[model samples]
Target: MLADMRDEVFDQDRACQALSHDRDRLVEAMDSGVADIDRLTFPDGPLTLLDLAVHVTMWDEINLGVVTLALRGRPHWSLDPRWETAEAGGALNVGGVRAGRGLTEELIRHRFHAVRQAHIDTIAEIPRSQWEQELPFAHSGSQPRTLGGLCHYVNTPEADPTRKLTYQHAAVHLGATSLSRAAPTGTG
Candidate 1:
């Protein structure tokens, strides 16, 4: 049973399934909210739906790149010089949001959907056997340094205890709290 569980853990199909499930939840959550994504704003939250879409798409793009590189026997260490450091992640998010401003609402939505599809498609390309292959870079602590681990880490937020199985980052952004909040004063 241990071997079966281990096999399932690193299986490409399982990884894609988890990713697709979270993406569906996020899309459903977004669809049920304010119809005008350009005007969808959260009270006390820094991002509008447009901004949030850009931010999420940016991370998806990054994940796609990382997985693509790993598949080619390359290390993703230089994708961000300080990618391994949690403190630097906020800056990356901030920069993505800033850079994505001025994009049309339609374009932002399109990119978000397209990039997510590409990310899942890329993950599906990883072979079952190589899913557990250790990545070239050194991982923090005993966290699995395999290809599956990289995908799991990028998808799951630091605060989530469930780790490998959930997309807590998407939940943090598109969850009930974010959906229910009223727009902050003076912003749309």
Candidate 2:
């Protein structure tokens, strides 16, 4: 019991620190990326840099809800209607993320911070035992995932899920590859 208590604090601290750093990097990327938003586009889809930011916040929020529900052992995606729409459409669907609201740079940035705080706050409140409880997303594979797993999934990198939630995944990793891929090849 004592060991679990220590592990819980450690895990929550690790998650909080990682998320804070990720949020910083995300904001930095936004500062630079937004300037060229009009020129950037994903070849496989219709996502602009702004669209990507919305997508990041959009799914991150849903993941927050998932973690919240899982902690209670009632892991269902009874979250914002917008998230349901996003899930229905697919990962890259800008329309689903937008949900009809016009996304200004300011709003997206604000939303980014707000959602990150929501995720951080919610995860912080969970007891240690809950972190290990398996909670599948609306459409997950056989392998079970927990709150810690989700945090690791977003913070850590792997080949699949190509687009991660934020920080190392979205702002750093995806932006790293996509910046070059999205750039037009021609003499300026």
Candidate 3:
């Protein structure tokens, strides 16, 4: 039991630090005014720098709900029969981008900071046992089974390889390749 508590604290610290670092980097990018926030970064999709901020914000908002529900020991509301028809987050992603479209850059940035802080706060307060409890939302192969796993997933580089656009390119003015070799840090 004591060992489990230590592991939970370590995981929680790492997650909160990562989220804080990610939020600062993204915010610095948006405030820099160097990148064309609206310019599409990829040919395969309509993702702009602003859209990326919105995308992350959307996921943070969703996770907040998931974490809150799990903390309360409530069955995940999304585990309904209608999940059969859901497009496994493709729809959610598309709708997130669409919802962010045409919004002022300031609004997206505001939400990016607010939602991230909320997520970090929530993660910090979650009980040790709650962190390990398997979330009902883990249906997809990529989905993490526990709240701790979800916290790690959203903050790590593998979750969004294109994170370079928001981190290195915009924040540090470095090449994308530089971030590819960088490891996830425990420091904020």
Candidate 4:
């Protein structure tokens, strides 16, 4: 059983590494503006470049905080929208209007790079033994998940498929069929 657990930890480490790499690539690509971040779409609707940037930043912070808590054997933060929104406001503290006032591609890029680096560092510092330990996280409210499970949730093939479908739906809803049409097959 210990060997199995160790193996799982190794797998989780690999997965975390991959996620870090992928996130780095995403930050690089967005910073480069090669793909036009302004046109990015989410599952809910179209996002302005600033909106996408904010979402990415928020996602990184939330995920990292969860992983950090898991490593420390503490309850993860609540995922209640109201609570999270309040928490996010306190942590991020920048409003859209304020963000828009002085936003530049370079600035957004720098922020994302910093955020990504912090996540990478957190993942690297945590020990493998903690991967199997349950920590509180919240999709809707505080719940428990292993570090390995969180890693898997973020990168699982199933998640990719689901996100792709969600993006397609968003495109359709927004009358942005061109975006959906341009998406590569098997993107997820």
Candidate with top lDDT is 1
Every model's Cα RMSD, please?
9.0, 10.3, 7.4, 9.3
Q: 1-188, model 4: which lDDT tens digit per residue?
A: 01112112234445445545455445444456543433233443445544555555655666677667666666455334564554454444345424533678677767766876776677766667676666555343211266666644432211122222211221222233233212133221
TM-score of 4: 0.54
| Model 3 residue 99 CA deviation in Å | 1.5
Ranking by lDDT: 1, 3, 2, 4
| Model number with the top TM-score | 1
Candidate 3 lDDT score at position 76: 48
Per-candidate TM equals 0.71, 0.59, 0.63, 0.54
lDDT score, residue 41, model 4?
A: 31
CA displacement after TM-score superposition, residue 19 of candidate 4 (Å) = 2.1
lDDT per model, in order? 0.61, 0.52, 0.56, 0.47
Per-residue alpha-carbon lDDT of candidate 2 for residues 1-188, written as tens digits (9 for 90 to 100): 01212112126655665566555655666677642333233335555555656766766776676666666655544333453453453643445455524766788878888987887777777777777666645323222366676555444323223332222335443444232211122211
Q: Report the alpha-carbon TM-score of model 1 versus the true structure.
A: 0.71
- Report, for all candidates in order, the number of backbone clashes: 0, 0, 0, 1
Residue 51 Cα positional deviation in candidate 3, in Å, after optimal superposition? 1.3
What TM-score number comes out for model 2? 0.59
CA error at residue 160 for candidate 1, angstroms: 4.1
